[model samples]
Structure formats: C-alpha cells, structure tokens
Target: MALQVGLVGLPNVGKSTLFNAVSQAGAEAANFPFCTIDPNVGVVAVPDERLTRLAELAASKKVVPTAIEFVDIAGLVAGASKGEGLGNQFLAHIREVDAICNVVRCFDDDDIVHVSGSVDPARDVEIITTELVLADLATVEKRLDRANRTARTGDKDAIRERDVIEALRDHLGDGRVARTFPGELPPAVARELSLLTAKPVLYAANVAEDDLGQGGEARGNPYVEVVRKLAEEEGAEVVVISAQVESELAELAGDERQEYLDDLGLDRSGLERLIDRAYQLLGLLTYFTAGPQEARAWTVPSGSTAPRAAREIHTDFERGFIKAEVIAYDDYDRLGSEAAARDAGRLRIEGKEYVVADGDVIHFRFNV
Candidate 1:
C-alpha cells in the first residue's frame, strides 16, 4: 500500500527538521527506498519487529518492509486561500496526499523565532484550519455553480447534486470542514472535489527534548496539552515528538542509537510513533511473507480479503485465484519455521474470502 502523509505547518514549526530525519532514515533503509519521490518527499520503511524475527527464522538473505511516504508541503501563512506566501501551492500539495500531519510548535526558545512571535497551539491550529476550510469553500462554490447550471435542464440527478452542493456550501460557509459535515457526500462528487479538509489529519506536538516523556508519564509541557485537547475536539490523533531528538537519533546506529533511546527512557523514536499513528489514521495493517530469499512486510487496508491482499504482492496472484497458506505470528514463533508449523498443524489453508490479518505470515498458492 502507498501511505502518503503530508507535513504542513507555518514556518519555524520544525517541519523541515522532521523531514530531514525521515529522509535520512529512508536513505539508510535500502538502496531502492523512495527517499526522494520529489524534492520534498521521503519514504521510510514501516518499523516492524516481526519482519526481523521472520527473517531470522527463515535465514533470509534480505528483509524488506512496507514503506510510507512523507511529503513536506510549503509553509502556510494567512491568506493561503488567496495564494499569499505560495498558499495555493501548499494547499495543492496537501490535496495530493493521503493524510495530513500538522506539525505544531509547542517548544519555546529565544533562538528559534516563532512566526506569530509566541507559541499558541490554538491560534496556530485555527490559522491552518481556516485556510483549508476557505480553500474547500472555494471548491464547493465552483462545483455548485456547475451543478446549478445542469439542474436547469430539469435532470433529477443534476437537481440532487445541486442540492447537495448547496448544502456543502453552507456548511463550509459556517467555517466547518468537510470531514465534520453531517452525513456523507455522494462518492463520485466527493472524489471529484477531493476537498482538502476531508482528508484525515493528526497533530504532531513538536516539543523541546526535555519536555518529551521519557518512558511513562508526560514531562508536563502545557503546550502539548493544548494540542492534545484540540486534537481531541477534532477527533484526530496526537503524537508528541521532539524534532531535536529525532534529528540526533537519525545520525546514530546500532548500540549507539539504542543507548540514546535508553538514556532518554524511550523505547523508540518519535518518527516511529508518528508512522504507526499515521497507519492507524488510514486504517492500515501489515502482513508478512518469508522465505530463504527474503522476509518482507506488506500493508493492506484493514478488512481486506485474502485475494485482495495477494494483489499487493502481484496482480497475477489474485488472477490465479487460489487458496492461501496462513500462519499467525504467535504460531510461527512457537513452531519456529514453516515446515515446523505445517507439521504441528499451526498453518491453515484459507480461501479467497479469508480476511488477511495483521502479523499473518502468508504464502499464496497461485497458478499464474
């Protein structure tokens, strides 16, 4: 699956710093990782321990993990709806992404000047939300104009569309986002508009390193609390991160990296948490394939059937239309290998209707 999340915030929110860490991690993951889909995009491997363990069990020569793309959108400013400070370009970039990760500045520092002079999560969120809502309002109005013209022909479908568009117009006019609008729009119209505000969003509270939680409780940054509360109201997820920590972690490897995290009393870096949350935001899950040649992770939207997941590996796998060999990760860990799992009756044959599960080890039996 191609999970793409766009990072957007006003200047000086550490968006660029966060992207730099992602870029380095992507580059270090593999030779073919999509570290540079474009000037501002980086793709990193989805962190999964099962993939590594499977590789060990299979004695695989290589390991490949599913990747997610992060796009660094242009900085936003007031009047983005009217194209101020390249606002139009920024909004366009966001429209092309699957989800949005708004990096909000929560850490205060005299050296790092905030665009608004002082950090205020409420004001920062409002500015971005207003811009997106304004842009969506523009889109709804244009679409309504065309729908109204079509409705003049007395076409029932056009009339219905015009009514729907009018409703959307009013909703946006009330300073509401499309995602929060009551009920759902027709699928076709929704796709046509591709309203930016409709995309799922999460807030990354970029705090100072010292303010980040070590292992358990939060370090008590009032800024993070504000972001968390705002995210709660918006029905969005929040990931507290320190760009400074991620940046330093990106430059270390092996025991050095582990040592750094240990000293900080953290098990993983913030980028890892961000990616995991992003996956949840998009309703994604990971499954695995293991062999002597390689052990790999593949992502699929939750509730995907066996045949649908087979398509992620190759279209032919789905075309062949055969059963799948499935082994739960726990069974694999206990039995130790495919042969062992088979002998122990831990592996089962599943049909096309079988929904692929997270952490499932699958071997598709296909003819094509």
Candidate 2:
C-alpha cells in the first residue's frame, strides 16, 4: 500500500472539490467556510499500465495495484494555532498522514468567496504554512518542558531529547519550519514529534479551466506562476489542475473522459498527476509480481534491499529470507514471457544484500 497524504488549504481553495473528484467519496463541499468539518478519507488505487500488460502476458486471474489513502481535512485559517476556528480541530487530522498536498486557489471566482477576500496564492500559502509552523512550535515547546524535567534526573536519553527539542523550539519560534531545521533527526524522535511542517509538501495549484490549458507548461496563469515559484523555493513539486474541471471529469467514463480531456488539451487527468507526485514526494517506487493466478504491484522505498522489500509483502518473508528470482520489466517485455526470460538468462537470482530496483518483476524464495 502507498502512504497517506493529506489535502490541506485555506477555505474555498478547491481542496474538497479535488478530493471529491479524485476519490468520488462525496466529501461535503459548499461555498462557505467550515463546510467540511470532519476529515474525509478515500482510498485510491495507484494506476500503472505495467500491471495491465503483465496481467495479459501472464494470463493472471486477477490484478491488484497498490493504493493510497487521501485525507481531506478542514480548511485552515490565519490564527488556527491559537484555536481561533475549526482549523485546530482538523490540524490533528494532518498529523496522522505521512505527507501533505497543499491546494492553493489560483483562480478568481466572483461567486465563490475567498476567505481572505481575494485570490492570492502567495498569501494563502503563507497563511497555511505559518499556521503549521506555529502549531509545531507549540508542540515542541510543550515537549521540551517535559524533556527538561526528565533531564533534571540526569538520564542520558532525556538530556539528549531536551537538547533536540530546544533547537526545534528555537527554529519554530523564528517562524522556520521543521523541514528546514538544520540537521537530521533521529527516526524515533521524528516519529514521536510528527511535526506537520516537517512533512513533505506537494503544491496543487487550482487554476481556472482556461488557465489549465494555457500551454503545455501552464505557466501563463499568473496565479499558478506564484505557486510555482514558491514550490521551487521549498524544493517541492507543483501540479497545475482545475478542481472544477476535475469534478466534471469524475462524472465521465471511458471514451467520454478521454474525449473531455482531449478537449481540454490535456493528455491526462489531474488526479493522475496527483498520484504520481504523491509517490515521488514520498520517495516510493513500485515493483511487480506476476503468475497465472495473479498479477500484483507492490510499493517500496526507492533504495530498499531485497529482504527489506520482501518485508512489505510479509514479515515472515523477511524473517525466513533466502533469495529472489528477479526479471527486469523491460527484459520481460522483450522476452515475451517469464519462461522465455528465464531460458534467455534474463532472469537473475538476487540475494539478501541485493538492492531492489524500480520495475523489477520479483518472486521471493523464502521459508518460514
């Protein structure tokens, strides 16, 4: 399975529209503030043409692709850290996710009211980022106090924790995000804190229909450009999409959806971009396992070792480790079948130390 990614933005930024369109979960979205009070989660399958092709080649009875859980949280406000609005209630929802997808309103709509009175992508991003930073600041400060109290007992671990929390508090107090904090954090500490700002961010610039197809790059949209520049500064990715267009696309099917996308001068739906970007943001890759029974896709971190990747399938697979019979996807495609690939020596045996690569067709050899 893919990791969870949260969709967040200020009110009226088309966040729920995108979520509803992508997940088809009918997240309640209206033209007012706080319409979506509860977090709406939708599990979406990650699409891969390789899985379809492999199924055909192997004559598999079924196909299963990895999935991601998308959480649509309530809109944030300027003073959310201080419990000014519903933002505080929903910020906790974000802490449950692995990464963030920040939706920015890049379109101007006279009918849809902007929470800030006008559409300003830069300001909207700042408002949301600042709130997250402030909230994390409060969290670190509270943790630091406890750490300091424990440090008084002269516990080595407690003393080290107090030092790290102190630095984090100083960074957040200066309006700096945890992601940009100076050094690497211990994995345990990172898991314990779960700072919102520390999560990787992918920007979704919600543009108008006309702006969506402005050009191949879609840089003609001034509002989208603002978001693009901001994402660049943060070393993030920007996906240009019109939430209204996506909502309309969700109602379409088969040829109809393709025709509509062609009419929009787009080759794919924004949801595809969202899924693709989310994987990249999380540093994930996919590998496949195929047979006459089933063809399935699996998600793993980019540099995962063969045994580590096996753990994703089952802990027992890792515990009783041996070797993995692997075929490169391209080799399998050229050889036309797994048997042919093995006969042609395109299949290789990988050991525990073998690092798994993306697009590998793997069959693990293990014992309990």
Candidate 3:
C-alpha cells in the first residue's frame, strides 16, 4: 500500500491548491470555504533521477516509479471536533492517513478568503491542534471506559492498557497531542485509540511567488515564524512553497520549467521538496528492480528485511524465500553493468536477514 498523507488546514489555506499542484488531479480549488467536501485522493509517482539512470543502464523496456498517496481532506473548522462545518467528517478522513501535511497559509490574498478572518498561523495552529486534541480525547475516553470495564475482570493486561489510555487522556485533556507521549505505544493500543495529532506532521508553508527563495519571509508572513517554531519543538520538518508559483511551474515544458524556476531564483520546485519530505516522514526507502523487461522502484520501510521487501513486490516472492542479488545504485553507476560490478566484487548476495537500504538496486532470486 502507498504511504498515505493527509492535507489539513483551515479553509482557504491552499490545501487543495497544493494538492492539485502536486497530484495534478484537478481537485476543486475555489475561493469559497469548505470547497473540498469529500476527500480528494491522488497517487503521485515519486520522482527519482536515479531510477531513470538505472533504467537507461539496464536498457529496460518500462520504467516504473514508486508512488505515494496524498489525501486532500475538507477544510477543518475551529469546532470540527463538535461536527462544525463538516468537521467531524473531515477529522475522520484525517484519522485514516499515516501522516499529515499541515498547510499553513503564509500568503496574503484579499481575494482568497481566510476562514479565521485573519492570517495568524499560531492561532490557526492552536485551533486545528485543539480540534484534534478534542477528537483524540473523546476517542481515548471511550477506550479508557471500555478498558476500565475489562479491568474489573482482573485482566492484568487490560489494567495496564487502561493506565496508558488514562495517561493519554490526561495529556490530551491538557491540550497536548498523543504523539507527545515519551515512548512508543503498542500498535494494537495505538489502533484502538485513534489519536489525530499523533501522526507525523510536515508543515507546508504556502508562500507567494516572490517568496520562493526568500526563506519564507519576503512577505513578512507571521505563519512562517510560527511554523518554524512548532517544527523545531516537535523535531518535525517544514517546506516553504508558493502554491500559485508551483501551479504555473507545473504547466511549463521540461526545459522551460527549469528556466522558469531559475528565473524565480529557486533551486527546485517546492512540490518536489514536499514529496521528498513526505517520503522521508514515512521512514520509507526505495529499492530498484532492473532488468530488460522493466526497471522499477519499490517503496519499503527503511529497515525492511529481505523477505518483507519481496512481499512488497509479490506475495509469491516472499513465500518462496531465496537470496537476493544486491548492488548499491552508486556502484552500478560507477561500474557500468551488473556483470562488471559482480566481476569487480561490488555485487552481493544477501539473505532474508539483510536490511534493505535506500537506493539499493535489488534483483530477487526466487522460485514459486
């Protein structure tokens, strides 16, 4: 399954605009609030120049890039936890995602309405955070109640579970997110208590065209400062992008796009940075399968075992476990071919215990 990320923010923060620009899925982007009533899902291919080069080296007939899923949920209101302005429904959509791309509007456009009536990223963050906290508090409370009932039966595990849930409830009650907890909770416990704010966050600072290379301050935007501080405290990542600029950049032809970005004094598209950050946030790594038939990239968690990585390709591959022929992308690029790399002792045969690395070119040897 593709790693899922939810785009969330107050109304008119360009959540849908950034979604359309990244996914090219033509999601509704209007000046009105709550334009995206239903969640807009788009599967975007992760861009990798290394994949293209590997495909060229292998002389493959088809090249497949790995993809990530982006979900553009409806605008979240201040009282979304209480079902205000499609709030509960949207928060449900957010709960289903693995991570969040919090779109904080750092741009100013009188034509584009701000749902909060002003641009205050700190206040916007508070509103959204509070709603998520409220939603999580309700979820944790229900779970705690159920666990409390189960605890009376003298199930020691249930008592421990109740203790954790109550602790989480207290934290959420204090306007803190579940992710702020000190240690990792069991997956079962986490699944039972759907915590909205616990998901990893990537702050997308929506800036204007002039602010492309200006470190998000050309417009003297306040959200830039607020997001920076929040990210610092949470040890999260942030990327500043001009949605309007990227929308226009997406329309240009290949060479023209580079020229346009150069004209704007930008090194690369904010959309690219956003995608890269999302990929990293998921702890995902890409491995390549190169052959004459196809050269493809596959996404796997960073520490995925060989068998687990094979399962991502096909269940049969995992079931029929065998050693894998692996070569780092850099070795292939330097040594020119698989045979040459093998002859030079750069290629390796790894077992099931081998943990896959990012940018690894793997050829699985399996018999089904």
Cα RMSDs, all models? 4.2, 1.4, 1.6
Residue 269, model 3, lDDT? 81
TM-score of each: 0.95, 0.96, 0.96
Model 1's lDDT to the true fold?
0.87
Total backbone collisions for each predicted model: 0, 0, 0
- Give the 10-residue window scoring lowest on summed lDDT in candidate 3: 212-221
Runs with alpha carbons beyond 4 Å of true place in candidate 3: 214-222
lDDT over C-alpha atoms for residue 164 of model 1: 83
lDDT of 1 at 235: 96
Q: What is the C-alpha lDDT of each candidate?
A: 0.87, 0.90, 0.86
Residue 190, model 3: Cα distance from true site in angstroms: 1.3
Tens digit per residue, CA lDDT, model 2, 130-221: 99999998888887888899999999988887887898899899988898998666688788889999999999999888877633356678
Candidate 3 CA-lDDT value: 0.86
Candidate 3 matches the true fold with a TM-score of: 0.96
Q: Which parts of model 1 have CA positions greater than 4 angstroms off? A: 25-39, 216-219
Pick out the ten consecutive residues of candidate 1 with the lowest summed lDDT: 27-36
